[model samples]
Target: MQKGKIGVSSDNLFPIIKKFLYSDHEIFLREIVSNAVDATQKLKTLASVGEYKGELGDLTIRVSIDKKKKTLTVSDAGVGMTSEEIDKYINQIAFSGANEFVEKYKNDAQAIIGHFGLGFYSSFMVSKKVEVITRSYKDEAEGVKWECDGSPEFELTNVKKERRGTDIIMYIDDDNKEFLEDYRVEELLKKYCKFLPVEIAFGKKKEWKEDKQVDTDEDNIINDTKPAWTKAPADLKDEDYLKFYKQLYPMADDPLFNIHLNVDYPFNLTGILYFPKLKKNIEVQKNKIQLYSNQVFVTDSVEGVVPEFLTLLHGVIDSPDIPLNVSRSYLQSDSNVKKISSHITKKVADRLNEIFKNDRKQFEEKWDDLKIFIEYGMITEEKFYERAEKFVLLKNTEGKYFTLEEYKNIIKDNQTDKDKQLVYLYATDVDAQFTFIEAAKNKGYDVLQMDGQLDSHFINHLESKLKDSRFVRVDGDVVEKLIPKDEKQEMKLSEGDRLDLTPVFHGQLPQRGKANFLVTFEAMSENDSPVLITQNEFMRRMKDMAEMQGGMSFYGDMPDNYNLVINANHPLVMRINEDKEKDLEKDLKGMKSKISTLDKRRAELEKAKEGKKDEEVPSAEKEELHDVSNKLDELKKKKETLLNEYGQKNKLVKQLIDLALLSNNMLKGEDLNKFVKRSIELI
Candidate 1:
């Protein structure tokens, strides 16, 4: 027997391994099982190279838990290490400067184990004592046993004869006795080894006999030696890929399509990415893409491996080039990882373009489901945007689809405004904005349906991409103002008439929740609506963007601003104008005469004081100027009050305002009831 301490520079190595080597103590099982698999694969390689004449029998790895004894063992039929090989590989940890190593790698335990050959020592994280029994494949070799008790010291000695393989036995500690549970061990195996290259058996198969589960004679294998990602793409059918997708995500809706990625050039990468039917809540569907290294599951949180937008996809990505235990910093700086990400983005764009060009009908059928993902990618990744622009679609209110260039060409001749800027009118909801949509259609203009989750951000993105273009919601303004032509029409009402009618319209505006309206005039045909409700395009867009992104809360806190545009050419507005002139003509004319005399006196007083300093100006002149301004303000207020009183009594004024409000889906309850009763009385 030979006993000695592990060749490490620090006595704190065991404690560090236990406390900080791995983020989760459960990963010890993965490390140990992976080591067993490495040994088995090495033996196969040697046998194929004519280096060993041994029989390559079943290389199944077995995991067994003994609850009573508190021991969990992983046994494998593969190349075993001899005494000399064990001294070089297991006993000596090759790192120097123990203090610096601990300081640099304290927060990264898994990275330490993977970088420095410390796989076997990971068992110390959850075990009080670990033992290894092995027999090399060499002829006339004897079995050896090695044991350690959570300390630097270890014992190595000769043991009884055994097959050419290895066995790792771990005595679970008091705090980690859960490792000794059958269900716990089985769960760990399923998580880390479900798709491993080697067959792994947890226990005997179970059967339901007399309403209770009982062990059967057959061994229960917990891993599949070959998963769908490991095979050639040509061998798989669409149904096969779909079946594998169902296996990965049992409760999810069927994926729209898939991309089979197989690249061996600069780096080896193989995986299948499925486009899941994503919902509006993007955060809920993240972390669904599992990452694997040589068929061994590594992580499901692959934000670092793939582009941020690509994480919305679901499936598996297996690459032998990526290290089994990679650190966050390493992932960010690795060239291979960057290449892999770029390649994946390119592949996805290529597949989408292929489908779009070959079968556009099917593509349009799936656009409603695919729009959010495509728009998200366009907003996040610049390279993806460049490739995706060719296939990204623009769906119109008529349910017809067109690409960016195609739609631009179709509308370039008619939709270009006076300033040469192309206007792309869109509706968020067809039913809610039906009036506005019909108005646009009546003018021989096309309106797009931009109602997806990411359409707000996507519209902004397209504006930046498509030069000399801007997107406006159909309800953002009146049809004439949305794409104003070079021609202009004179207003029918004079400035004084407009000023007198402003308060009349303002008094009839509804008191909706958090919404403010500004009375304005637009000269349109008599056939148009009497009153139109429109929001400013830029302000509305800012509010919508504020809801989708952070750092723009200021816009969200502001009240909704709408424009109450009264058509000057409409018969109802003309009647209101005529009625106000006829009823308030005497009062308004007298008030205007008084206001004019006060204004003339104030103007003369201000002109006399303009050229003189305060001391030179007479005190009487300043006092007279102040009195005249106050009198003028009072007269104007009186005139406005009279107009408002007359407006409140005019049922036509209230009816027009209510009609506009109802069309905008803003009039409710009492106001709607009042409008209905008023309509019946008018009829």
Candidate 2:
């Protein structure tokens, strides 16, 4: 195979570099400011190494805007370039002097991010013309002036400069004159350079004077040179972290906890992540984690950099190991990124574990706020789930918290089902599900309050991870069926009696749009409420997940189905049965006999014609069978009408159904008003 060198044409190079060097035009400001930081850091490195024997004056980098001229300038008090140095580095594209300087002074120049060489060209992304005035730190080396427009042409000349630093001035292009506005430039500086190592000054500090704001001589320093994350853990106090958290999120509720990550062995990473008081909207909490490199703010969107669950946290992470330019594919494949992500997950888990072990009470106090983050982590990351299981807490309606294992031990003997699966009963809302919660509590079973936004998904995740343990909402079933240690209680009514009594309770159900009710009879203890409403666990779970996640609209779109369970053994229910028998006993017996006769004949005819095809069956037999089926339907309808008429006059039936519906927070409007009036009349 023949090989040849890839060539880049001079004519296309300038435009390509300006248009595609960075993603956004606003990034030009970040690039120029970062280059200034690199130069300032280089000067500090020289002074430390004894190569530059000169007093290092104030190393502040200043950003200023000239709106009238539509120009932007960044000035730094750091190592400047000589005429030849400018020719070698500036004239050549993608050759940063900071790289060479950092390599030579690698031990002392830890702060140098090594971006100035090529990043300088990024200024052209938003500028029609650019000028560089720089003076060498070496004595008697002449100052140099370099200027370039949007083309591949440049001018260099000798220039008088007093400062031993660089000043990059850009004539803002018409399309990007927004950069010339003082507020816009200041906003960019704060976004990208707020945590930089060197002080960055944007404008004069403003003070309130005579009810108006006026500029003062004091510089408006835009960044905190020594941010909390850059310092050693021993040097920081709790208050220091709190102050940093406030700086990051001014209006957020105080965080539940903070994880200060400082790692250097596998990869350089430093950050302070705070677990904020998360709301129901997970989307709103994301993109709060900021990513940085050597204190230069890179981006607030850190999804690819951190574990997905950790993005829910609010904080800053700075690592030179994580490349300045991060893309999804690059981050997913990069070894350094993988290491950093793993390390951060471990740090978060470790911090949570430490707090739990040292201060149990405090951990419980913050459980509500910390729960969503922990649950989200446990759901998304296997390693995180493994670690979190040790500290993740379960809170009950009694307001007590326990670890998964502890909760299992506390409820095992009472909650283990006939299938030997442990049951974890929970409620979404303490007030809304109060009756069910109390029902479980009355039976000496603990009811967990899983009310957080992600708790629905978290419950599903826990079921998969825990050993044969299932989480059932308190309202998922009656107490006996929820755990099911014993076989289901047989309904007290007979097969015929059950069918005859269905209409008694079913007929009184109020019309609820998109809601379906199935009348069920359960032989519960007389002490229990006569009627109770319960939703099936699996169907409810699908609907809950559909609301939180995508691709499950089938379940969400299905009409709500609830079991209106009639406690057959309850005194009031037995009394309703007695009253129904008194009113419809003669009519029910006559209907039952006729129904049996028709059903028996229908079954006989169906069996006789089973082997015979439809065409072989005689027309007389088909007509006789059809008449029997019609008679069955007519007899059933008459029986139902008789039971319904009896139920209409029975206030107890209405009150019991109303009580069950009200307990579920489902009774409303005219039905509720009628229930109150009927209850008063009965009293």
The alpha-carbon RMSD values of the candidates against the true structure, listed in the order shown, are 2.8, 5.2
How many pairs of residues collide in each model?
Answer: 1, 1
User: What would the TM-score be for candidate 1 when compared with the true structure?
Assistant: 0.94
lDDT of 1 at 230: 85
User: Any runs in candidate 1 off by more than 4 Å, and if so which?
Assistant: 97-117, 324-332, 596-627
Q: Would you estimate the TM-scores of all the predictions?
A: 0.94, 0.91
Model 2, CA-based lDDT: 0.82
Runs of candidate 2 exceeding 4 Å displacement: 1-8, 94-115, 208-214, 326-333, 487-491, 596-630
Q: Cα lDDT for residue 625, model 2?
A: 99
| C-alpha-based local distance difference test score of model 1 | 0.86
